[model samples]
Target: MVSPKTRRVLVIMPAWNEGATVGTTVTEVMNLNEGYDVLVVDDGSKDATAKVAAAAGATVLRLPFNMGVGGAMRTGFKYADRKGYDAVIQVDADGQHDPRDIATVLGGLETADIAIGARFADKGDYKVSGPRQWAMVFLAAVISRLARTKLTDVTSGFRAGNKRAIAQYLDHYPAEYLGDTIDSLVVAIKSGCRVTQIPVAMRPRQGGTPSHNPAKSAIYLLRSVFALLFAVTRSRSKIAVQEGTL
Candidate 1:
């Protein structure tokens, strides 16, 4: 376990067109008094998301083009690695994820290399679609079965990783349909990392529609399932290669 004196945390907010909510998110996180250095990776937002984040006291990293969430996250992870922070926490710019929950993730990080916020662990915090919720549960079960490790929530974006996990991810960003939530978890498991889940509070977005439209949500589910199958079929040699390099 790392002592508070020894731990240096960097909070990375990968945001795009979240100008309405980023300022409040930043304020809440700053009020947490967690001694975190915050970075808001502006994912090519046409709005004043960058300006809002900056005004709210977060360092901003702007991407030239609008890369997806995966790209924005990778950029923040790379910066976290370069800056030599002991750990990095990835939080949403939208007001759904709570900043006060950062401590729980950090506490979990003591025993696990990666600690993810599992919404299903505690009921009633979120009101997701029945089908989508069931899909996540089924996917988590399959991932647990394949990886031989129990994971309650496989796709929740609120997560924190120790320096080791950060280094591996920075060394190689997963590219095969990496934007989807489940595939990223699969890649982390394939790279031989310890993952643990903790219950965290979440709310519906304070503004704007969900990034996943109906058609895209369906496609995401199908592709995520296929990703699990692909990860399962890889040879031991391939897994070893991935482990050694990634």
Candidate 2:
């Protein structure tokens, strides 16, 4: 087991027109005591997101066009894999994720292949609407049963991935909205990665509109269920093939 200090970690922030918050987010992550480098993937924003992130002392990767969070995350994973980073941490550029929890997430990587910063794991002031909360609970239960592990927050994006997960995601990542959270976890679990969650506090976005509205949330939930089912079928097929039954 490599020590945390010896491990090369990259903090990847997928930003799209987050000019108002990316700079401060980058600065805060850079100020952490863990000594992790920061990389901001500007997903073809029309604003000054790229320039602002670069000015904030973070390496910025600008996409040719908007690719959503999942695509940006794939780019970051490829960068990390090519650069041989020992671990990668995903943080939101809208200032929802706390930089102080970076170390806590990384700490989970010492024993598990992935560490998720779960907002509802220990309870705080984080609150969602009644309908959204019900949807979250339903999805969490579904994911937990499928993964055969207890998961409190299935949709949380604040997560740390070790070398194996980084390498896996470089080639196999979901390319849909909210895929970075739900679909990515299913991929990681089916690929035999050990995953655990740690309690973390979340802050409201500092700027820009949220990616999900009420209508989008409904679409997200529906698509996510289908995606989860597809993941399960794929996993079963792989198992059958290994057992010489497929």
| TM-score, every prediction | 0.89, 0.92
Clashes of each: 0, 0
Q: Which pairs of residues have clashing backbones in candidate 2?
A: none
lDDT values of the candidates? 0.79, 0.84
| Model 2 C-alpha lDDT per residue in residues 1-246, reported as the tens digit of each score | 668879999999999999999999999987775678899999999999999999999999999999998999999999998898999999999999999889988899877888989999875679776556766787889888766778888889899998877766765788776577877788777767778888999998998888778787656656767767766665422332343311
Error of 2 at 179 (Å): 2.2
For 1-246, candidate 1 gives per-residue lDDT tens digits of 567567999999999999999999999999988789999999999999999999999999999878877788889888998888998888899988888888887777877778888887864467567556667777889888756767878878898998777866675554456333666666667667678888887887878557877776666657777777765554333433555633
lDDT (C-alpha) at residue 10 in model 2: 94
| CA shift of 218, model 1, Å | 3.2
Give the RMSD in angstroms, all C-alphas superposed, for model 1. 2.8
TM-score for predicted model 1 compared with the true structure: 0.89
Model 1 alpha-carbon miss at residue 5, Å: 3.8
